[model samples]
Target: MTSLPMSDYYFRQFEHDGADAPAGRKGRIFSAICQGDAPTRKKLATDMALRPATVSDLVMELIHDGLITESRPAQSLQKGRPEILLTPAPGRLCAVIFHFVSHTMHCAVVDLAGTILFETTEQVQADKIDKQGFIDVLSSLAGKCTAHIPGSAKQCGYALSLPGIVDEPGKRWVYSAYWPKLSDFDLSEVSETLGHDVIVRKNLNCELRARTSRRKSLGTGKTLLIHWGIGIGAAFISNDRELVLTEGFGEIGHCVLDPLSTVSCKCGMIGCMEAEAGLWALATMSQDQSIPINEQKFEDYLQDCTDKSFLKRPLLLMAHTLRNLTLTLMPDEIVLTGPFVQCPETFQRLTERFELIFPEGALVRKGRKPKIVSGRRSKSDELVGAAFDLFRTEIGALCRI
Candidate 1:
């Protein structure tokens, strides 16, 4: 099935009581400090055009609420009195992240500071159960993880990353090639089961791309991430903000790349990007050539390709598929990630082909070119991004207040 447009997927509705509280003077002050390098009441007040008294009151409230922590006094540069610095209190709150794969579910617990304290992976019986069974397992896992958290944090939020079209508006799993029975299921049942105060279910590719966009080390601005796994999915980020969330904007993998090609995608389509570049595609291709290609073999092949010595037909096909995607999207940078990107030779050839196709104008201008780099935090990006989702929500709440 063809994916829906971004405009049609705004199903979920979020309301904040403090969103219209006359822009609390103290809240404004807090926002300025939170957005800056070193938080100072005086500077915050000045930035927000509020009185120092108001800023001080807001600072005290934030400190008392365990949201911000005071640091050592700042060194006086000019002469007068030194000022105290404030920063976000790390680990004050935490979030749980679940990435639903084709045959397994990956889970992690992350702190407000974006640290993954724990993670686990377990194989799932994808073909056996109905909707309720999937929800029960996921909910049970989330409950267990939340209970395992060391402290007595009251607000526990969840983020689920799954394949296929997620109808955020309907809070349902619209479609999945791997989990066909889950397509029409209302996934929110898991949230209700866990009883978490806040729950977010999003496409895994979108969450991954959001994590990549928020990575400070990458220095990425606007970019597209192409994740090749059980399915081919894409995520888009512009100007450091995720524009595709809840909008279904990055279902490029489901886009029909070849109308007449005989290859069929799990989504019941022919010649889709997923059919072309997905993990199953590579595995199928490898098996056809009698190249033993399970998960371990896939990893070994990737290592060989990365070393620049291997160039099998399957790897070449993967490269050509990526090249076509890069040409079509023309994102500032196209990030090839997920398990498929593990193949070194495949990745190199893909990059080589990408350069060959666009050459100079590929992704960037001379000095300002977008660099395609390997994802460093493979396992943690999703969890960190999930934490960031809550962080953003909290920030938005503060803004509204």
Candidate 2:
């Protein structure tokens, strides 16, 4: 997930229709604008390595197509003339984002330019919502959201931030212990029934995509993002890659920590890291300690809980798991995201212990240890990421046209 350099124009795949068609450069320009840089004609030409006149022609075409909106920046103190800034138009393009979490589905309508136009959350009893019933619920929800879209906006389609390991190539769910009904479910078959072209992806990967979009620069180089929330969802990134939407991609949650530990993961695996270090592990410990599960102020509770020795073992175990993952993957950066990792001391202790255990002198003695940084977008990174990914897709498609 290396940050795409502005000079790189291959972010999208565009078939050259003919000599009459706009080339890949057209897509490149549009993508850059959609990034919200609002580059002027001169800046766009410089970034894309095109003549100013060529950029002007593409800008005009894009403007004509309602793909971008141009506005003159107010007078600047250092500049001789005002430059027209190009930006993605609100309501011109949109996508429906559906995130399945717990017994609820968090839904939002997001614009291509990164605006959440509408959002709602609905709860369904997991036991009652069977596979067909779940699909029906999602279909009904999608219809409700789409109905609210402005008539002028172009609907790019629907994207799902599913809870399980999504086999995008196979269009099926590999496993989801919490939502067992979706295991081995064929999403493509349901896509037709839902009446929309769908993009199915693992929620972890969606969060990582959204995280990378916010940090367009950090997308550069190899990175491993660990969402240490209610569950541990692991995602990796390389340059110019789709979110890891494959079977067993996010199953790091099933990574067994202690072969003999009594803890059990929701996946029915004994001693899995999810059972040891996931939010459930913390919650279990809290319950055993007679601590109140303050859902409303969990972050504050986490800060207070970690100060005591009761939560140290799980945090330590979590750190060990992350260290194992780091050594295995050897990414440039490992992002500690999700609610559990938000505690500053918890994050600091994890990184400090990881650095001690994973030293070059002790381990490989080759490359540097990956830098650990906290995740941005504390709330709804998964939901926003789902929309951001689709927004980029829409921009790429629009550019190709």
Model 1 lDDT on a 0 to 1 scale: 0.59
- What does candidate 2 score in Cα RMSD to the true structure? 4.9
lDDT of 1 by residue, 1-401 (tens): 11111101111112222423345444444444444677677777676566788677778877776767777664668566678887766456667887865578877787655566667667777767677787767776776677667673434577776666776556667776677677677766665677764455555544554454544554435666766656656666654333544557557667764567677776776777666656566557553453333444655655654333323443445555555555555456667666556755456666776566546764443434346765522555555554555555654454334
RMSD values, in order shown = 7.3, 4.9
Clashes of each: 8, 6
C-alpha-based local distance difference test score of model 2: 0.68
> Measured by TM-score, how close is model 1 to the native structure?
0.75
Steric clash count of candidate 2: 6
Candidate 1 Cα misplacement greater than 4 A, ranges: 1-28, 35-38, 46-49, 71-85, 118-122, 150-152, 197-200, 203-221, 240-242, 285-297, 304-329, 355-371
Estimate, for each residue in 1-401, the C-alpha lDDT of model 2 and write its tens digit: 11222212235454345333456667767667765467888888777667889889889988977877888766666656678788856568778888865678877887654567887778887645577887888888887888888888887778887765677666677666557666678878766876767887777776666555544575456778777666677888664544343456657777776778888676776888777766656677564564433322556676666355665776777777777877787678888766566788777877777777777687473867778888653335665566554556656766664
Task: Please provide TM-scores, in order, for all candidate models, with all chains considered together.
Answer: 0.75, 0.79
Which pairs clash inside model 2? Answer: 1-219, 1-238, 2-219, 2-220, 3-219, 3-220
Which regions of candidate 2 deviate over 4 angstroms?
1-22, 32-57, 70-87, 216-220, 239-247, 281-300, 306-312, 376-381
